[model samples]
Target: MSDFLQTRVGAALKDAALAAVITLLLASIMVGLRTKTEQGGLVIVGQWGLVAWMVGVVFVGRLAMSLLIWRGNNPVANAMNAMLPKQDTVSKIGKLVGPLLLLFAVTLPFYGNRYVIDMGILVLTYIMLGWGLNIVVGLAGLLDLGYVAFYAVGAYSYALFAQYFDLSFWVCLPLAGILAAFWGMILGFPVLRLRGDYLAIVTLAFGEIIRVVLLNWYEFTGGPDGISRIPRPSFFGLEFTRKNGFADFFGLDYSSMHRIIFLFYLILILALITNFVTMRLRKLPIGRAWEALREDEIACRSLGINTTNTKLTAFALGAMFGGFAGAFFATRQGFISPESFTFMESAIILAIVVLGGLGSQLGVVIASLVMIGGFEVFRDLEDLRMLVFGLLMVGIMIWKPRGIVSSRAPSVFLKEKKSVSGDLVAEGEG
Candidate 1:
């Protein structure tokens, strides 16, 4: 017992020291840079006191966590385990909760403040992006870091057509998706022979290529200035104008919110379509081929699957959904810019898929809410927001390394259904 106590104390001190070092590395720059001063000629001013305070906090907190929460008989772990629902209960809760959440979403505009409604639209946008990327990265086991290229394609497709052709948003929407899918196929065919890091690098290059082209092609893409005044989407034959429009047709007072509400539902329907198509496809032969291709390409070839076609289809479908979301974004914002489609956007979408637990639709939804919505909640915190975000992510990784929902339900189960451990699946091989 004496030896065990010594070990725990030693472990606590070790963790505290490690935390202090990391805190110094991360917080030193942040705290040191917090001072604001007007200067034509700059002076290097740093807040050493703030840095010291941050390091002290980290050391104490880490030591306490290591000793009381991480070591043997951890109360935090015990409490969490106790609070967690049984495996069987999860499905029951989902069944009961899914519809409730949907109903809340559908009715949110009526009851929610404008700010809340706006946040809802933003969250749903990322959710759509996450679901789209889930197809390529999660279902098909492709490592695509340039998914946002297709998003830009879709946006540009809509913006260009609407600009030159005097086309309605409805007309441009499908065309955008088709164009993006074509680009997806183009990118897909060339990268079919590559896998793992090579595939990721190729995709990343493709994204940069698209962005650079847009940046240089000033006449065609408006260069860095971006396309503006892109028409907002309207209800069929009914604009949401203040007079003689949707509000007038319905005999309701014209509020700016009508347009916002319409965009919300439009994206919602599109997201649902993406979800429905993905779910239905999962039951199809092509979807099974994707799962097989993900697990082991060699085994997949041995089983006579056309790996090339499978990969292309996954890319095409994923790009199609991304295009749809991009078009919606263009319509909602009434603008399209090369700046809007960056590598960071792709990173966030991919992170959503990985953090959500690959190929789990519900997990993607939950992860989107937590990541995107949670980030929005921290907007007031400014620089501190990122610090909190990093810590929260670290905590989650420590607690559930596989993700929030790590256990996957088998695509085809025998008489007894069982949850497959995430460890059993290869990366992106959901």
Candidate 2:
């Protein structure tokens, strides 16, 4: 036992020593470079900031090595390293956390300022869009680059219907969803046999076609001028406009802030619904069929799963959600234009899904927050903002090629306890 302990400790110390030496060499090179590259006629060592940074790096490296060597022999440290929360406990915590998050989202606007509320709404909107795309790309393994086309369809559908028929937002909303779903099925048909890059290219082309059509079709779509003065959502025959609505009804001074808050909660509710529905679907037989098809389409067919129906359903459902988001966007902005639905929009949506783990809801939320929220936050930086954002994305991919979140599928089956490794047990016995 003493021999084994000594061997492990010695090996750890050797590795740590090697790592420290490499680190020290790198630090020295950096210091040398800094010394050679004079700034403001000052030497490298003369720069207090640079010297302090280099010294701190060396000190930290040595400290880390010492800690590793010390901990190598400690039983308590070994046990702490091996410790992990039980699966049941993790699941319970997730169950609790999800609802609490939803509640926070719902009520955030009531307490937050107008700017914060607006940002929250934007985040939730993207979160919904990300989750919707997740269903097609993540669960169904369908690469849809033309998703923004469906969004455009929904927005335009609402705009046209409202303009021509004088319909309410509530009516236009579902109509837009249905129209988008129809378009989704149409897009899905030709790409049924396609996979990977080919599917991506085809979808890309489809999205471009939609945008081109909207650009050229002036009479119906209003072309470059776009549609404006589109109606905002109304509640119980009361319009949200400042002139005559809730503000006066409640005897409070009217402001756009209230409308912003209302929209925030409206989208929050929509996002929650989207999340709930997708989660429920994943547990159902149809959802399982999608997952199996994603894993292996041929095998899914061999198992008697209807590949055509599964594919269509995934496309339709994803498009429907995109449509819902589009309609909301149209109403929220009170405008529609060809520029709103572009290839860039599709790319950003895809990035959200990919950067988030493919099938993770929480990951989608985080990714949307980071991507969309970060973009908005960095808007003031202009060109530099995009450069930095691109670099940040590159860094994240290099660090986590799979995704920021690794686990995609929810663990449906009961987790069995893992047995100790036979080799480890044998070593212990010896």
Candidate 3:
């Protein structure tokens, strides 16, 4: 027992020291950049302060992770296990929470502050995007670092057609999704045989290619100036204008809240549709094929599954949902640029999917809320925001390294269904 204690303490200190050194190196350059003053003056300052703060944060984080998370017989895990409900109880809780959340969302427009509603829209957009990417990454085991390419395609498809052809928002919505799916298939074709880091590089290149095209295609995509004044979606044929809109039709006072509310529901419905389709797909043969391929491509082929079509479908479907969210983003913002659909956007969506517990719908929603909503909450902190965000992410990874929903509810069962803990599942075991 004495030797074990000594070993644990020594390991924790070593981890903390390594963390401090690495944080010092990375944050020194990252958080130390020059900044513009309010008076338009430039200052190459704040390096030492940033480095000091980062080092302390990383040291403490690493220590805590080693002591509380990775340590054998951790009390934190013990306490959580004691408190955690059984599978049946969790299902009961979910049934109750789902309806209540939907109810709150439905009435939020009437009672929620504008800022709150806006955050809701942002969260839901990422939720949809995360769900879309979940198909490729979680189900099909594709590490696409450039999923934002489809998002850009969808946004640009909607914007260009709406501007030049004068199409209504409704008319262009599905078209945008289809176009994005087509691009997904096109991109998927070249990288079908690749996997892991090589596949990631290819996908990243694809994303950058799309962004560059949008950047340099000045004649078509407006180049760096971006597309602006993109029209918002109307209620059926009724525009949401103050004079003759939903409010006017319903004889209610017209507030801009109505517009925001519409967009909220629009994304909500779209997200729900994405969730529903994904859930339904999970029960189908192709869906099983996805999981099979994700686990072992060679085994999947041995079982007579066509790996190529499965990957393409996953990519296409994932891209389609991303396109849907992108179209909604364009309509909501009334403007979009290549900047809006950067690689960082893809990273965030991928993060949400992974952090939410790959292949879990409810996990994606919770992750979006925590991540996007947490960012909004910490927006005023500025310099400290990323620090807090990184800590939270690392903490969660340590606490539940697989994700919040690390237990997989099996899609098939012989006698009764059982929740399979991620700890028991090997890599690609799903």
lDDT sort, best first: 3, 1, 2
Of 1 and 3, the candidate ahead on TM-score is 1
lDDT for 5 in candidate 3 is 42
Q: What is the C-alpha lDDT of each candidate?
A: 0.87, 0.79, 0.87
* Alpha-carbon lDDT of model 2: 0.79
Off by over 4 Å in 1: 1-63, 73-81, 428-430
* Residue 251 C-alpha lDDT in model 2: 81
Q: Lowest lDDT 10-mer window, candidate 1?
A: 35-44
Which 10 successive residues of model 3 have the least lDDT summed?
A: 421-430
- Model 1 score (lDDT): 0.87
The TM-score between candidate 1 and the true structure equals: 0.88
TM-scores of all candidate predictions against the true structure:
0.88, 0.76, 0.83
lDDT of 3 by residue, 1-430 (tens): 6575478787798779988998888887888665757666776776688779889988999999888876659888687677878878977786687678778777877888999999999999998999999999888888889999999998899999999999988889999999999999999898878878889889999999999999999999999999999998899887887897888899998888888889999999999999999999988898888877877889888888888899999999999998988889999999998889788988999899899888888788889999999999989999999999899999999878988776766777899887777776433422
lDDT of 1 by residue, 214-305 (tens): 99899998999999999888899799898899999999999999888888888889998999999888888988888878889889999899
